[model samples]
Target: MSERRRRIGDGLAVLAGARPDVLAAAPGARQRFVALGGVLLSTGALAAVSAAFAVGMALGVWWPLAVLVGLGWGAVVVNLDRMLLVGMAHDSSLKRNLVMAVPRVGLALVLGVVVATPLTLQVFSKEIDTEIVAMQAEAADAHRVALESDSRFAGLPDLRERIATQEAVVASGGVADPGLAVVRAGVTEKQAAYDRAVTLQRELDAKAQCELDGTCGTGDAGTGEAYLQARAAADAQTAVVTAARAELDTAVAAVAAAEGRSAALAGSSLDADRAELTRLTAELDRQQAAFDVENEGSGGILLRLEALDRLGGRNMTLAAAQFMLSLLFMCVEVLPVLMKLLLNFSPPTAYDRLVQLRDSGDVELEEMAQESRRTVAQAKEELLVLAERERVDRQKEAILARRRAALAEVAARTEAARAQPEAPAAEEPAEAPRQLWDTGPIRELARSAAVRTVRSVRRRPADRTPTTV
Candidate 1:
């Protein structure tokens, strides 16, 4: 257990960007760094939770995938925090420290805000969900209204009414044409006239019979003038009834003909009308289905965020709570950087001094190494220059020796030519003697030139050599 605890401590110290060896030398700093590491760990865990919630709620990804992403996000946060902590060396200069801390704080601030949003949304999940439902309903209503108002579907209502009217007409064995209705009305009027005429004739006949029997009409025993008059009237009404019946029959036939024509027209167009109606109905249903789908899937991150904003706006307490919660999470994210910066502001600790000493020792050693290399390089350059100078001197010496040998050989040849000169007057000419005399000074001039060349070589400075340290 002790061993495990020790290992855990070491791991946390490393996570805090602290050297365990350095901390070992200064036990006082170990707890401080370990606590920082614990803060980092907690921050990472919070970040992971936030990421998981964001992925699940905002992106609507599968839970397992969200968890994987969360783990990756947590690792990234941990690494970024470690870098922030490690980058801040314990400097005594306040200006330098501030300069270094500003960017880091800014970065951490942005990260804190990003990490806090999802958690904040989760905190108000219930309210957000309720708001999302309301929003979806509102959107659906708006879409429905827009669809209704759209010109493409403007004929839907008319189509539906027409379909209903036509269906009723077909079911009731009625005609939809105005001419058919007029013909039927005429038939009804003619039938009423014929029935009236027939009724009159019956009443007159009854009266006549009554008169003959002396039952109720006039008390006359035999057929009198009144009875004869009633009989005549009854005969006239019979003719009227027959003519009225004939007109009624003609009107009825016209109605039947009109009905037949209407039926034929309705039959001819019914399929086409129904097809149009069905198409319009399907279009309306498709629009409704699309709206339903959109409304159902409307619970996204943006909507949730908007809901949270709305809630915050409506309730001061909620807004304050949201602000405070966000601040709390952000502070957690920024804690490591702030802690390191504050520690920098204070006097350097033992660990800082030890690290400084180690770094200074390294710098000194590196300087010594650089100096040694420069010295070695300078020495090598000087040796090469000296060797070049020696080669030049040797070459000058060889040239001098060769000049001396050539001078000596020329003198010997001159002496030999002079000793053999008695036979040369006829063969060689007087100009040869003058040329030999001119050659006498050549050796002296060559000797002087060789002396000057040797002097120039000796005087040239070895400029390629570097200065010694």
Candidate 2:
């Protein structure tokens, strides 16, 4: 005899508020729960800190304790959850199970506090004096000390000796010291020397010209006027020479600028092409990373595509499976209703038309039951296939969406890079480059590793068989 009837009796015991377990609480189970609760709270906190530490390390920090704590925390917390679940199964009443599920939630909240507390502590504990500010202060102090150093004072004598030599040169020429005279005159003393030289040179030249050509009317000209004309001519010649020097400098600057531009134009397009390739490669990498997140069994692009096709075929069969499962769950939900209908629609006291139909010595009624059984069997087979297909498809779509989003992000970044300036040539100076132009070694290293992995994977002939471990 099937125990469906006995099972119903047990359900009634539960509903009637009778003791459902042998003990009010299982002693062994209770101790396990307490231990799990404590460990989860403690270890979970430590794990968060460890994970944060690991992230910092990856970013070039060297906090060893974080890695140790994170590994320990993760291991302890995982085992703690498992142990807690085992203890929870001791009494196994649906009502009690529901209440105990809440502990895990509480444990999670407490762990959050653990992670947050350390960060708060770090923020508060930061050094009051910054290294940059301290360094600047030290620099200023050093500069002041340099001004007062014996080394600085020693150099002053050499400077004074040069000044004395200049003074002697001025005195020998019967001229005042230009530097001192300028201060007294409230004008540059060099102007007086220039004026005298111009006047004298003109006077000499004018007299000599008249003597040479025999036509200059100023041969017997006064020395003062002759000096003035000579000075003007000399000033004009000096101005011409200065202008020529300035033009030469300007030409040199223009030539250097043009050479730089020409060299840059020749190399820029190659850098741009390299940058674009880098962006495309990055996008492909991101897509693959996203695909991995779903952790589906899809092994490659070709495998994923094939799985997608299989999913569609599986979906076509789902409609039939759904019909069967719907029927089965409905049967469970309304089993009481069915039992009531069978036992108490009040079996006819006298055989009525309906009773006559069911009792007709009826071979046809028996055949109808057999047909119903066949239908149920076919429905079940279809349902199983549908269930398996759906599971596969759902995993595939999740993986696909992740990969798609990753790919899109990579593409956007790469396309944006096109508008950005290319990294300068290796021969170029570092100060001249922008951040976007720096691809950073990490991106390159990851790419090379990926390439090597793919090449290794390709070297072996692929097995068409599904992976089994």
Candidate 3:
């Protein structure tokens, strides 16, 4: 258990960018860094879960892929947080610390919002789902209304009404032809006349029988002139009734023929109108079906977010709860950076002091190394200059020695020539002075001096041998 605890502490220290060697020296700093690491780890874990939920809901990706994406996101978040923590070194100057921390805090705030939103959405998933359903219905209705208002389907309602009117006409057996209506009216009047005639005839026949039997009406016992007149009228009414019935049959046939003709004419137009109406209705239905398919199940992250917003607006309690929850999550995300900043503002901890000390020590060590290199380079340059001066001085002394020897040799040769007899002019020739000037010893000395000077110049300071006088 102690070993495991130590390992865990080491891991956390590494996570917080703390040096284990340094941390071991200062045990006081270990717990602080360990706590910071815990915050970082929790933040990363939350980020992963939030990212997974967001990816799954927003992109509708496969679960395994979403999990992979979540893991990657968590790693990135951990790296970012680690960078933030590591970059904020303990500083003595409050102003410098603030300057360094401001941008990091701002970045953390942005990250916090990004990480919190998805978790917040997940928290209110049920409410968001319900709101999303309502929103989808509203969107569908709006789209339907927009489609109906489109010019292509603008005449749809008129077509339906026109088709209905035409259908009614066709079903009613005929068009409203004036000639047919007149014929029907005439047939009706003739039938009425025939009915009246038949009734009169029956009454007349009854009255005649009653008079012959001497029952009532004329008070006569036998058939008289009145009875005979009534009988004749009865006979005339029977003829009228028969004629009326014949005319009624003819009119009925004419009306039937007219109805057939009218029905045929109207049926053709109704069929054309009905076909157009069906085509228009089918087109509208097709468009509506496509619209439905396009917008079906549109519960993406954006939609859910919008739903959450709407839910918040409709209920103050929910709004407050959502706000509080979001704030809580964001606070968690921002805690590490804020913690680092607060620690920076406070009196330096032993860990912070050690980190500062180690960092300063590293700086001092680098500076010392650079200065040493510069001093070495300067010494080397000075040594080369001194060696060059020595070589030049030696060459000058060798040249002087050669010059003195040549002068001495010329003086000796002149004195010897004077002591000896004057040589024959022909034997000496006119080139004697030139020969004296270009003597062997002097040339040898010049040659030796030249060789020695070349050797001396070519040799390094360490390799140089002393010149012979």
Best by lDDT: 1
Candidate 2 local accuracy as lDDT? 0.45
* Two-way TM-score contest, 1 vs 3, winner: 1
Per-candidate TM-score against the hidden true structure: 0.74, 0.18, 0.69
Tens digits of per-residue lDDT for model 3 on 1-469? 9999999988987998899878887998888889999999999998999999999998889999998999889889989999999999877788998899989988888888999999999999999888887887888899878877899878888878766665665687764544477878977998888788788888988988887877876878787987787788788888988998898888888888887787777678877877887887788888888877766657888888889988888899999999999889889989999998888878878777787788899999999999999999999877877776777687778776776776687678766656665566667565534443445565676667667766765767567553322
Looking at model 2, the pairs that clash are: 198-231, 199-227, 202-230
Sort the predicted structures by TM-score, highest score first.
1, 3, 2
- Which structure is stronger by lDDT: 1 or 3? 1
The 10-residue segment of model 1 with minimum total lDDT is: 460-469
How well does model 1 score by local distance difference test?
0.84
Q: Each prediction's Cα lDDT score?
A: 0.84, 0.45, 0.82
For candidate 2, the per-residue lDDT at 230 reads 58
Write one digit per residue (lDDT tens) for candidate 2, span 201-312.
5666665555445456555544456546655665675665455445545554554444444344434443554455456446545554554443332223233223333443
Best by TM-score: 1
> lDDT score, residue 168, model 1?
58
| Structure candidate 3, residue pairs in collision | none
Ranking by lDDT: 1, 3, 2
